[model samples]
Target: MREVDHIEQLVGKLLLLVTPLEDRRLHTDLHNFTHQLSCDRISYSAAALFHIDRSLLTSCIAAIAISIYLVILVEFGLPSLTTSVNNAYGVPNLSEISSYFVCIVMNMYFFVIYLFDIDSTLQGPQKTHTLLSLSLWTGLMVLRLVILAYSSEMVVQEASRTQRLVTKLQMLPVPASSGCQEELLLFEEQLARSPLHYSAAGFFALDLSLLKSFVAAVTTYLVILVQFQIPDTNKE
Candidate 1:
C-alpha cells in the first residue's frame, strides 16, 4: 500500500513538474495520462502467475542471482568435454564457456527487465510501451512459478489465528472511557470484511515463503542434474 502511495506521488510530480516550453503536445498528453493515472489505483498481474508488486522486484533479482550461481556451477563443477571431435578441431570446446558468458549477460539483462517492470507503474500512451510492460509482467509471473512455491493454506491459518487473538484482546478489561477500546473495535470491524490474503486464481495465496520454496526447489533440481551429468561426462 505504501508502494502504491509512492507511485501516486511520482505521477503527481511528473504531471506537476512538466514545463510548458517543452514539446507542447507531448506535455499535454502526459499531463492527461498522469491525471487519469493519479485518480485510480493501478494493479498489474501476469496471467495469474504473480503480482507486479515491489516484492516482485526483489524476487526477480534473487532469482537472477541464483542463475548466476548455476552458471558458476556449470563452469567449475562440470567436467570438460573430452570427445574425439574436439581433437579433430585441435581447439578446446568453448560451448560451456560461451554458455557461462551468456548467463552472465542475461543476469544483467534481467536487471533491465526489473527496471522496466518498475517503470510500468508510470504507464504511457504508446501501445508499444504497454506491450513491453505486459511482456515483462508475463515473464516475471512465469518466473514466480518456476522459481518459487508456498503453501497458501499455512498463511491463511496463521492469519486467522492472529486475527482471532486480536479480537479476543478487545475483550480484555480496560478503562471504560479509554480510546484504546474504541480503536481496537474499529480495527476489528475494518478487518472483518477483508480476506487476509491475495491468491493466484484461488489456487493459493502468495507470500515470501513461496520465494524460499522456489529457491530450494531450483537448488535441488540443479544438484540432481549435475549429479546425473557427471557420470555421463565421465564415461565420455
Candidate 2:
C-alpha cells in the first residue's frame, strides 16, 4: 500500500537521524542498535493497541484482555501443595506474593503508557501514513535513555580506573619528580578533552525530553486532523 510505503520511509528517515553513521566501522557497530530500538517501539505500541487508526477503542479490548491475562499468568503461578508443608513452618501469603508481582506488573504498565504517549505525540496529521511516527519517537527516546545509562556506567568505571592509576603513580619512587608532574599535567589536560571523561547523561536526558516535546506537537496536529475529517459522501 502507498500508505505503508510512506510510513516505512518516514520510519527509515527517523532511524537514520537517531543513529547517524559516517564511517564504515561505526555503521557496522550501530547496525543492530537502531533495529533493536525500532523493534522495542513496535512491540510496545502493539501492546498498547495503538496501531489501529480511527478504530474504536472497544474493537481492541479482546486483544488487550488476552495480554492482561498473560501478564497475570506470568506474574502469579500455581502454588505447590508440598510447599504448603514448608508454609506450616512459615510461608508468605498469596496476597503478599501477588502484591509484589502486581507492583512489577504496574511498572510494566507505566512503561507501556510512556511509550504510547510518546508515540501519539510524534505521529501528527498523516492518516495516509501507516508507519506510526509516535512509535518511532518512542523508540528514539528509549534508545537515548539506554545510551545514557551505558555511558554513565562507562564513566564510573573509567573514573575508578583513573583513580587507581593515580594512586599507583603517587606510590612510584620517581627520581625526577618534575617528569612526573609534567606527565600528570598532560594526563589532566587529556582527561579534560576526552569524550569519555565527559558525562553525557544530562545531555542525553535533555535530548530525549526535547524529542518527546516534538512528538507532542505532532500528536496535536494529528488530533486536529481527526477532528475535521472530510465527509465521505460530501452530501452537504
Worst 10 residues of 1 by lDDT: 77-86
Candidate 2 has an lDDT of 0.43
Model 2 lDDT at residue 109: 36
Writing each residue's lDDT as its tens digit, candidate 1 over 157-222 gives 675775687689678654343344565565455446444553343333355554555455545654
Q: Please, what is the whole-model Cα lDDT of each candidate in the order they appear?
A: 0.52, 0.43
Cα-based TM-score, every candidate: 0.25, 0.24
Off by over 4 Å in 1: 1-187, 190-194
- Supply candidate 2's per-residue lDDT for 7: 60
With a 3 Å backbone cut-off (N, CA, C), the pairs that clash in candidate 2 are 119-134, 121-215
Candidate 2 residue spans exceeding 4 A from truth = 1-133, 177-236
Per-residue C-alpha lDDT of model 2 across residues 1-236, encoded as one tens digit per residue: 34544665665665565544355655554555556554654322344535434343554554355445434432332123223323442223233323433443333333343344432433444521333444454455446544644554565467558745755665554324225534444444443444232222222222234335434554565554433432421333
Error of 1 at 228 (Å): 1.2
